[model samples]
Target: MLPTLAQTTALIRHRRSIKPQDLNPARGVERELVVELIENATWAPNHGVTEPWRFHVFQDEARHELVREMERAYREVTPAAEFREDKLQKIGTNPLLAPVVIACVMERHGGAKIPSIEETEALACALQNLMLSATAAGLGSYWSSPPLLDGATFRAFLNLGPEDRCAGLIYIGWPREGLNWPRSARAPVAEKIVWRAAAGA
Candidate 1:
């Protein structure tokens, strides 16, 4: 069944990033629920039906591997003088804060029909679908594009091909105790929309 217009708008408005720091480490989201969330992601619009989105879910023991490899890559790439141990610590430990981690990879499908940008846009839409699904499930989630994600070692861990580039890792877990969901202010739609029905009107 499709969501009603009001329900759809409610989801768009209610979706917000719940940072890993604001998530409960003990109360993890179940694997079954995560699988359902990813399935929902596939429903996002894809031009020419390329379906360019690929997700690598990190959970349980594998989450530890993800953090270790990422930290190692960070240390290898960063100059010793510029390397902050605190930041390295985050690379080493942040995944432990979340119940699950999803490595968002984009395999650019190049052909006569669509450009790389369009493929990436399709992947972005898929991610939005994922977040909306997570929110509707009452699960707190956030997409994070950390610098460690760009390092070669991290890519190697993901086993992505030369044409594939990762978007980032998304963290998912239950909302942290005693923390409120974040709220942000946006400019009025009138300020951004330019209605030009006629030429130079």
Candidate 2:
């Protein structure tokens, strides 16, 4: 059966960006569940059916290699005066805190036909779908976008083409025991919207 409108709205509002540290590293998300989430993600709209998103999922020992490459990229992109050892350490450790880390990418498929921005927007929509699905599945999800992801070192590590872009990294796992679900608030719709009446009706 399809979900009610109220159910859909509730799911959207209930979705939260849980940090990797809050995720239970010992609890593993099954491969089938990951595939289901990604399948839902691909349902997101794309211009001319470009279907540009690519997911490189890293788990188990693979996350270690991912962190090593991330550290290398961070060093290569950051200036000497701006580099932080603490940030590097965090980068090296964050992936291990979650059971699944997905490197989201937007591979250019439309060339000059479809704008790159639209492709990126599609990828963003895909990620939103993925996160919503995770929320419904009682899983915690986080999207992390470090500047190092844009660096050539990391792109090369992911084997991305020149036109492809690494959108972000999504971490997924069960929440740790005794963790409280976070609550959030938003500005009133009236403040953000300026609706116009139809033909002075």
Candidate 3:
């Protein structure tokens, strides 16, 4: 179910990360709703329609394959002596915690007029759109990059190329009761924004 405009704003402002265990077990989001959220995400501003965003969604039975690949990658990277049995167990368990795991990949377009950094920033905006849309849809989402960035195992699992970079991993699921937290306070807008006039001219 979608929220009203004011409710949507409130949802976005209050949305917080719920631990995997705190996600509702029986309330997986429908596939159509996921598609809708992604469609809305595309409305974000893009510099040249390069549209470098790519999403690989892992869900239902397909999540098993993703988990298997993640474990394989983890083993490849973990040194024999340093590897902890529990760490491997956690890796195997991570993806199943969410109803949907979205791989947010930034693809490089040939002959891009702007720098690669600009392309990545544009993708970030798209991700924000996705997060907000999920909130409005009564779902909880967490944007994570630790596993995608530091885990060489994760890189191999995704088959990332030289030019391809991971922007984040999005985990979406229904929130358990009392799982939502209040928003963190921000610095004053006056302190963050500045107006420059030429010596009061």
RMSD of each: 1.7, 1.3, 3.3
Model 1: per-residue Cα lDDT over 71-129, one tens digit each:
88888778878899899888777798898999998876757678878877888888998
lDDT of 1: 0.85
Cα lDDT tens digits, model 2, 13-103, are 9999999999999999999999999999999999999999899999999999999999999999999999999999999999999999999
Span of 10 residues, lowest total lDDT, candidate 3: 146-155
Clashing pairs in 1: none
lDDT assessment of candidate 2: 0.96
Tens digit per residue, CA lDDT, model 3, 48-153: 8888778889988777887787677667766789777897787677678888888887776635577778778878988889888887777888887644244666
Q: Which stretches of candidate 1 lie over 4 Å from their true place?
A: none
Off by over 4 Å in 2: 197-201
Which clashing pairs does model 3 show?
73-153
Ranking by TM-score: 2, 1, 3
Error of 2 at 174 (Å): 0.3
RMSD of 2: 1.3
Clashing pairs in 2: none
Better of 1 and 3 by TM-score: 1
| TM values, all candidates | 0.92, 0.97, 0.82
lDDT of each: 0.85, 0.96, 0.76
